[model samples]
Target: MNNRILVTYASRAGSTAGVAEAIGKTLIGKGLQVDVLPMQDVKDLSPYRAVVAGSAIRGQKWLPEAMQFLSDHRSELSRKPFAAFMVCITLSMTNAGQYLEGLKSWMSPVRDLVHPVSEGYFAGALDFSKLPFSLNVLAMRFVVLIGVWKQGDHRDWSAIHAWAESLPSRLLQ
Candidate 1:
């Protein structure tokens, strides 16, 4: 059997999951066998030749399960072609470059642990209805008060697709 490419992700409010799916579809279009699964569902890495992992950012960190997945498979990951991505509403804010700089600081725990051949930073969606009951109140009120955040989908599909298009060659080579 051909070694498949694994695309695993952790999502909250669903934006990151959509991004992961898009990555999986793009890879499939490139004629590579792929499997996209939630990070928690993946138990082994031996069947895959490459990996792409991502998570939604909350309080500036990858979700616990996503981080744990990487830590658990660090050895296997180090030997394979790997890539990572992140979804964050902060990326839609002004001064995105600075936001990314701060995001890097937040992602230190993961970076210090494993290195990916490439990394993607994409804007995320924000739907007040999807946020937890408590956060919904806070986020809605915060948006109304600060006028800094708007509720809508902000993912850049062109960028996401472009990034994914670059992966097969890099990984398969």
Candidate 2:
């Protein structure tokens, strides 16, 4: 059967968009027809066999548009093979507990809204330079005090690819 997968995300500074694109590429490589789109552009989910939705977490919550998209399509999503991920600096490669919590929080809404076949948390990048001045100052202080805000890409590409590849297998069953 031909599988149509929709990968949607709400990104603030492109990290989440990158993750969504990577997932779409991986699914395409696996022979699925994938549509990678922003949450605002996805008004319906009836065309897809499976859906992968994600968003960057801000203040420990999904972006409003992403949340609304899920809320609007909850029923359709529940009937399909679904997966989710969250982009957050809280999931830096070195912090296991924070990563777990970020993943849990990211997936919590998905779990409550749909029965996802798989879910993952990928380490997110935080560029202090790209942040607004207020956020940058806070991040700088955070880096200085707690050493949590390193300035570079920390995404785990291998893990993301693996996670994306595994989705089809889980959903096919």
Candidate 3:
């Protein structure tokens, strides 16, 4: 039997975790065994045949733990099929083309560091209420005062599902 697929993520405020769960569930529906875990919770890559890793973006970079995971498991990961996704509100539906262009630039570190078979870019969810209390209040006030931050769920479920469903064959190819 093929080894299980691992859908691991590094999320702050949980949006990326939700995306990882959706991916894991879609793979399971296709009769693949899957393990969905946080990057911190993953201790072994030996059990997985392929990996789908993602992280929420802050400023313009992936979380430290996600980067560390890739760094720590570089050799093991290089031997298997891998795919990556990034979650950022800036990549909203309205700006998907820029998202594609930005994907290569933003993921340069990953590309330079490790090879992946495919990549995904997704719009992220952001709720000011979920941020730390002081930061939330500050961000809410900033939004009201300057209209810089957009707060809402912008993730496109159908797109995420379609991408997830394509992975098994993608790995094969």
lDDT on C-alpha atoms for all candidate structures: 0.87, 0.80, 0.86
Candidate 3 lDDT tens digits, 22-73 = 9999999999899999999999998888999999987578888899999999
Question: What CA root-mean-square deviation does each model show from the true structure?
Answer: 2.0, 2.4, 2.3
Error of model 1, residue 114, in angstroms: 1.0
In terms of TM-score, the best-performing candidate is 1
lDDT of 1 by residue, 81-142 (tens): 88989898888877777767767776678788888888889999988778777874585558
Best candidate, lDDT-wise? Answer: 1
Q: lDDT at 62 for candidate 2? A: 82
Off by over 4 Å in 2: 97-103, 133-145
TM-scores vs. true structure, each candidate: 0.90, 0.87, 0.89
Consecutive 10-residue window with the lowest summed lDDT within model 2: 93-102
Rank candidates, lDDT, best first. Answer: 1, 3, 2
lDDT of 2 by residue, 1-173 (tens): 35788899999878899999998899889988899999989887888888888888876778888888888988888888888888877667475664585358557766787777787787787776676678745855676367656667878888889999998888766
Off by over 4 Å in 3: 133-145
* Residue 2, candidate 1: C-alpha displacement in angstroms: 3.3
Stretches off by above 4 angstroms in model 1 are 1-3, 135-144
- Candidate 2's TM-score reads 0.87
